[model samples]
Target: MAPTGIVLLDTYLPTSDEIAAILPELIGDMFEPPDGIAHLEQLRLTAMGRYFRMFGDWNPNPVSAPKLFVRPGDPLREHHREVAWRAGWPLPHHSADVGGNHFTMMSEGAATTAEAISRWIDALRH
Candidate 1:
């Protein structure tokens, strides 16, 4: 699910010139000191051109509730947590701290993660 989100975000990012126009104020540190408004404008145009040509109006996912297979140490997990909190959810049904970086953790802990997800999926199936 999170991977899909990243893909979507990346897809939208290049085309989000309107959104990026405000990014300098929000993330002023992205540029070094003495950076001018032209830099920001350039960034907007670049992102708009990249994104506009990259993604379609819609994605191809079949389900609204996206499914993600991610390790606990993955940075995206934190983003997922933030989104869940912002949505006012009480808690996530399942998450585990599998040690390692993204690829390492996925390789080492795929079975455990799959088992955990299978449990939830099976419950829903019944």
Candidate 2:
């Protein structure tokens, strides 16, 4: 289904280096490749390079869809909250505190995140 709303979870809008740093941790012993870890590393670097190059200089474009910024209760919450406010998303911009750090928000905080999403979607439906 097409997305009715957008939920950003502990998102940093990471730079190439930041994205690159997570590659090893994320891909460790996960996949087998002919070229080994070098392949994954190259892929990560290339993809992040292109992604940052394309969107790095860009700002949020105006859209009609609703946007929800979900920030964990962490040091970066205020930073992301500010970013969401300044993002100039659609008129019905919203924010929610999922009550965990970035990683935990995805794991331990999944239920809260899901509930927030459900509530947002229900509101949109109405």
**lDDT value, candidate 1, whole model:** 0.38
Residues 1-126 of candidate 2 have per-residue lDDT tens digits of 556677766544433343344445434533443222234566776885787678775656656667888766643234444333222222356887776655566777789888988898899899
Evaluated against the true structure, the overall lDDT of model 2 is 0.58
lDDT of 1 at 100: 41
For candidate 2, the 10 contiguous residues with the lowest summed lDDT are 82-91
- Best candidate per TM-score, number? 2
Which residue segments of model 1 deviate by more than 4 Å? 1-71, 74-99
Clashes by residue pair, model 1: 1-67, 1-68, 14-47
Give per-residue lDDT, candidate 1, residue 104.
38
- List TM-scores for all candidates, in order: 0.30, 0.55
User: In candidate 1, how many clashes are counted?
Assistant: 3
Q: Compared with the true structure, what per-residue lDDT tens digits does model 1 show for residues 80-105?
A: 33332111111222333444433334
Collision count of model 2 = 0
Q: Candidate 2 deviates by what RMSD?
A: 8.2
